[model samples]
Target: MPSSRPRCSAGSSSWSTAAATPTSSARIAVSIERSRPEAVAALALDAYGLSARERQIAALLLAGLSTQDIAARLYLSPHTVRDHVKTVFAKTGVRSRPALTAALRPI
Candidate 1:
């Protein structure tokens, strides 16, 4: 039998990260194009044995936040966040944020 899952076009997915907007409210609003939940991604990352901090950073990365932004938001050094990210990638078998997100797409 063929797989029941819907066939998507090449390079397409049902979800996408939110794009940056000019206003805080815009930042918080979820659009149809950006409907993927961070929690689902977090759950995916959980299978990799990530620490709480590492999971948080992974979620932010999936949300398209930069290392500098993650550092400011979490009150850590950018270097520290990068360290966590390196560990995350090592454990998760991914080398970049886009690969990480793709690897962790919801089951």
Candidate 2:
């Protein structure tokens, strides 16, 4: 019998559905469960003392996006994004992306 389970493909930053089967369904469920905590942690940006714009930029930065990419997503200029990044660094006392990510990651 043809499997009815969902087949997922790795998209840019998430899964894309192509077909369905029981095994794939289970995998998708597991993936979602695993990501739930990380998602909640990402929402806790306020704990870092970042402003609204800074929080948005920081979230995208933590997601591995470049300043240009974040600027495009937020429809702001690249310079503006860079300014926000610098502010975030100063506030968090981290001078680089990896450092910022490490500082913000849940213990």
Candidate 3:
């Protein structure tokens, strides 16, 4: 038996469906376009003039890492990470982590 599912054209949007076989069963495939986080971070870095270390710290901060966590990941002292966080806040004109995150978060 032939499947009753609708056939999707090549010009269709991200989501499209096609007949799998000459049977009642059909499979649907969906294509999703996602913005790269690195691209967003690069833009932010350029806009804010953040140093390489600062950008690294900012990325970790946005990922919900604490000072100690970020330091541990980077093999740095917690104090050093805290200093970078402070610099990031100052350069971004944000007073706190949440504010920095909100200011730099990708749309």
Candidate 4:
């Protein structure tokens, strides 16, 4: 079988970087920068003083989970999940998920 990855030529890269050569430190640095927002959001969430349930729901919200999905995962009803979401929004001082994300974003 032949490798699906393309040869590492000047103008072309492998179809998947997994089969490519090792990346440079600069790429690693960029990866770190790209990942910082999630860490920042998580840190901001922790500082909000949410209750255990509210924190769980808020974390799921940050992960982009829907109320039904969070309810299914946590064995709660959708109505309950929605109530938690609303409380989380109020506590975080944001009206919607995008606003919540923006509020938690790093300065």
Candidate 5:
């Protein structure tokens, strides 16, 4: 059986370290140290300037799903997934998913 518990990476220099979990197949649940939630929010805002849905998509992308896989999981059409990816690229100023992930990384 697949483990439900998530693997966590210690956050970057700008944010405090805390445990995070992968909850539903849809999204991960991260428990940031109390002092750092605001900073995390700020970093997310700065990096992608994404709406909540876009941010969720970007997060899923970072978790490494192909467009088709993303579509299947998100219940979106593949074309819609591609469109969101395009918007994600434009908003984050990154041409590719790897770049987008790197950009989303902590400062």
Candidate 6:
């Protein structure tokens, strides 16, 4: 039987590096500054049963921010961000952010 896999070329890294840079879609998706504010609010209301603060944190997480970024943006500590994440996990009954991601995907 013949294998159908393609070989990786030595020049792939340059292509990968170019593609890895953030583009307009990624910029839009990750725009902590530009994502719809009401949508985040509504996601909190419908999905996770989070408090206002927790919802804010969840919005940042869903927007691909790290805990450190969330903390810095919200003027909270990383520990507090982590705690909010824990509460979000508890309320949503999800064990991890990947699960949260999956739950939020359809919306």
lDDT of each: 0.73, 0.70, 0.71, 0.68, 0.68, 0.63
Task: Report the Cα lDDT for candidate 2.
Answer: 0.70
- The TM-score of candidate 5 is 0.60
Q: Show the colliding residue pairs in model 6.
A: none
By summed lDDT, the worst window of 10 consecutive residues in model 2 runs over 28-37
- lDDT tens digits by residue: candidate 1, 1-107: 22122122233444544333345454443333444455446556777899999988988888899999999999999999999999999999999988887788743
Q: Estimate each model's TM-score.
A: 0.63, 0.60, 0.63, 0.61, 0.60, 0.58
Model 2 has how many clashing residue pairs?
Answer: 8
Enumerate residue pairs that collide in model 4.
none
| Candidate 5 per-residue C-alpha lDDT over 1-107 given as tens digits, one digit per residue, 9 for 90 to 100 | 33342223354535555555666696666565433443453456455577777876787887788989989998999999899889888987889988876766543
lDDT of 4 by residue, 1-107 (tens): 22233222122221112232334553321111123445445556767878889888987887899888999999999999999999999888999999987676542
Runs off by more than 4 Å, candidate 2 = 1-40
Worst 10 residues of 5 by lDDT: 1-10
For residues 1-107, could you state the per-residue lDDT of candidate 6 as single tens digits? 22222222234221111112345564422212222434434544455567889778777777789999999999998999999999987887889888876565434
The better candidate by TM-score, 4 or 6, is: 4
Which candidate leads the pack in TM-score? 3
Clashing pairs in 1: none
Model 6 error, position 16 (Å): 37
lDDT of 3 by residue, 1-107 (tens): 44443323234222233333443356544333343545555576667999989999998998899988998899999999989998988898989888877776643
Clashing pairs in 2: 4-20, 4-21, 5-20, 5-21, 5-22, 6-20, 6-21, 7-19
Pick by lDDT: 3 or 4, better one: 3
**Span of ten consecutive residues with least summed lDDT in model 1:** 1-10
Number of the predicted model whose lDDT against the real structure is largest: 1
Model 4 whole-model lDDT (C-alpha atoms): 0.68
User: Tens digits of per-residue lDDT for model 2 on 1-107?
Assistant: 35432323244344333433346445432222123424444545666678989989888998999988999999999999999999998988889999888776642
The full ranking of all candidates by TM-score, starting with the best, is 3, 1, 4, 2, 5, 6
